[model samples]
Target: MAWVTWRQHRPQLVAAAGLLFALAAAALGTRIPIEAAFHRESLAACLPPAARTGCDIIVPHFEAEFGGLVTSVRVLTVLPVLAGLFVGAPLLARELELGTYRFAWTQGVTRRRWLLSKTALLAAATVIAGAAASAIVMWWRAPYDILEGRISPSSFDIEGLVVPAYALFALVLGVLAGLVFRRTVAAMTATLLAFGATRFLVTEFVRPHFLAPLHRVVLATDSGRGPGDWVLSDTLVDGGGRQITAAREDLAVTHAQLAGIDPHTYIVTLGWKRLIAYQPAGRFWDFQLLEAGLFVGLAALIVLVTVWLVRRTAT
Candidate 1:
């Protein structure tokens, strides 16, 4: 079974490996200079309040040099979908499209076993590729992550266990689509659409509620939320718990300035409080596990459904 799986999927396995290698090469090439600059500029020290002023100039310079690379990393977020289209969608769709499954199924192997073996082999490969890509990306972005935090959407999607889990979900989703569509092109298209929609839904709606976010009230003069904190909302409220409207804020600021008082100080004097709802940086690992587990569980459920479908439709 393993040998046959390998023979059938060698092209995909090789292509996936090649892509992972290219990504790693790119990450390593860019990482060298970034690491050098980090040490030379003493970026670690700059993160502290005592040295922040001095390092402010250096930080911007570093950003200026590597900002493009940081932005480019956002593209990695799509890799899981690509993996699904290329590896997972084609897994069964190609077999069924070309009528090869009929011949293969005539052999002594049970359809359930055949489906499980193929899915397992391909999914394992997808996971391994995801882990490698995640590791490389995480290392490449360490300096920036330290400064801005990994809790942000851009950073969170590419690091830790979640990346592999996402890949697995995509792969399984593709397989299910392939089984349902029975045409490679249609399966691929469906895989991309389903995977993208699911990702958007999870990131926008589900992620924030992973844990009940912490809330705190602060003086309006306080510098907003902490660096890297995933701030859900920042609203101004009075002691009476009435929300302060933006128009009222502008009027207050204008009045305070006319009276030669600091606008923030006047606002505070009026007993307006800044209410911050946020997920702190400390919950990075916890969130990673929660999200990874969610996707992995979904993948398992999809795999079960695909297996049932394959068996039911088998000759």
Candidate 2:
């Protein structure tokens, strides 16, 4: 069964491997200069405000040099969709489209076993590919992540266990789409749409509410949120819990200017505070596990549905 699975999916396996290798090579090539700049400029020391006298110049210069590469890397968030479209969508759709399912089903192997074997083999390949690609990206972006925060959508999505989990989910979703559509092109199209929609919904709606965010009240002059913190909301509020209007704020600022006092200091003196709801940087792994488990569970459920559908068709 393993040999048969390998023979059937060798092209996909080879293509995935090649893609990983290419990405790894790109990451390795770029990482050298990025790390050198980081150390040469002593960017780590500049993280604190006291040490950041001229980091404004140094940081922007470093960013200008590698900003394009970081942008390109962020675009790799769609890699799972590509994997689904090319590998998973065609897995069963091609067989069914060519009417080879009938021939394959008639062999001594049971339909359930056959489906499981193929799914397991391909799913493992997808996971490994995802992990390899993620490792390369993470390594390449280590300096950027250290300077900035990984809590940002672009960095978070491409690192840790979530990457592999997302790939597994995409692969399973494509396989399920193939089972339903029975046409390679249609299945691939459906997989792309479904995977994209799921990702959008989760990233926008579900992820923010995974854990109740921490709320902190600080003086208006101070933004207590750090670089890696995922700030949900930052609102200017009075002691009475009412949001301060911009017009009122402007009036206050003008009054403070006339009084020869800083507007920010005057606002705080008037009991205006910044109420921030955020996920702290320390919870990175917790969120990663939460998100990865959600996707992996969904993939398992989709695999069960695909298996059931395949069995019913065989009967």
Candidate 3:
């Protein structure tokens, strides 16, 4: 079963390996200079809960130089979908579509066992490949991540257990779609649509609420940043928690200047404060584990459904 599976899927396996190699090469080549420059600049001094005055002058320049890489990394968000379309969607669909599953199933193995073996093999391969890709990306992005914080979608999605889990989810989604659609192209399309929608909804809506976000209030003129927090929103509010506008803030500052009082002091007297909502940096790993578990659980459920459907078809 394993040999037959490998023979049938060699193209996809080879392609996945090639893609991982290319990503590693690109990441390593780019990361060497980035790491060197980061050390050379001694920008660790600018990390939060510490002096950041130098960051005002230095960080922008670093971003300007390497910002393209940052944008490029965002493109990897689509990688799992590609895996589903090419690898998983066609895994069973092609055989069933070609009417070759009949012959394939008669080769001395029960259909259910055959299906489970092939799916499990492919899933294990995908997890390994996805982990390799995640490791490469995270290692390459370490310098940028340290400066920018990893809680953002781009950083969080591509690192730790989450990336492999995402790949697993997409793969199972593709397999399920393939079984239901029974045509490779149709399955691919369904996989793309379903995976895209699930990912979009989770990323944009569900992930943020995994834990209640934290809040901090600062004086209107004072700097407010804790180390590596995923800042959700900042609002200017009075003691009553009514949102205030920038225009109102500027006017208040002007009035304070004319009255010979410090702007911050004046704002405090008026009960104006900046309210920041954030997910603390300490929660990075916790969120990673939670999101990964969510996807993995979904994948397991899909696997169970696919198995049930396959067994029914054979019966």
Best candidate, lDDT: 1
> What would the TM-scores of all predictions be?
0.91, 0.89, 0.88
Winner of 1 and 2 under lDDT: 1
**Predicted candidate 3 versus true structure: per-residue lDDT over 1-315, tens digit per residue:** 899789988999999999999999999888988988888888888876657577777877887888987888888888777778998899789888999988988788988898889889989998999899989988988999888878878788888888889999999899989889999999999999999899889987888899999999988776787656888888889989889887988999999999999988898899888999888877889999999999999999999999989888751
Candidate that beats the other on TM-score, 1 or 3, i.e. the better one: 1
Q: For candidate 3, what is the lDDT?
A: 0.87
For model 3 the local lDDT of residue 255 reads: 98
lDDT of 2 by residue, 144-244 (tens): 88767787677889998889999999998998999899999999999999998998999889988888988889888886776678888898999898888
TM-score of 3: 0.88
List the global CA lDDT of all models: 0.88, 0.87, 0.87
Q: List candidate 1 segments past 4 Å from native.
A: 48-53, 250-269
What lDDT score goes with residue 273 in model 2?
90
Best by TM-score: 1
Worst 10 residues of 1 by lDDT: 47-56
- How far residue 284's Cα lies from its native spot in candidate 2, in Å, is 1.0
Question: Which residue pairs in candidate 1 collide?
Answer: none
In angstroms, give how far residue 162 of model 3 lies from its true place.
0.7
List, residue by residue over 1-315, the lDDT tens digit for candidate 1.
Answer: 889989988888888889988988988888999999999988888774645566757877988898898988999999888778988898888889999899888789987888898889888888989999899899999998887788878889989888999999999999999999989999999999998898889888998999999988988788776777998889999988788999988999999999999998898899999999998988999999999999999999999999889988853
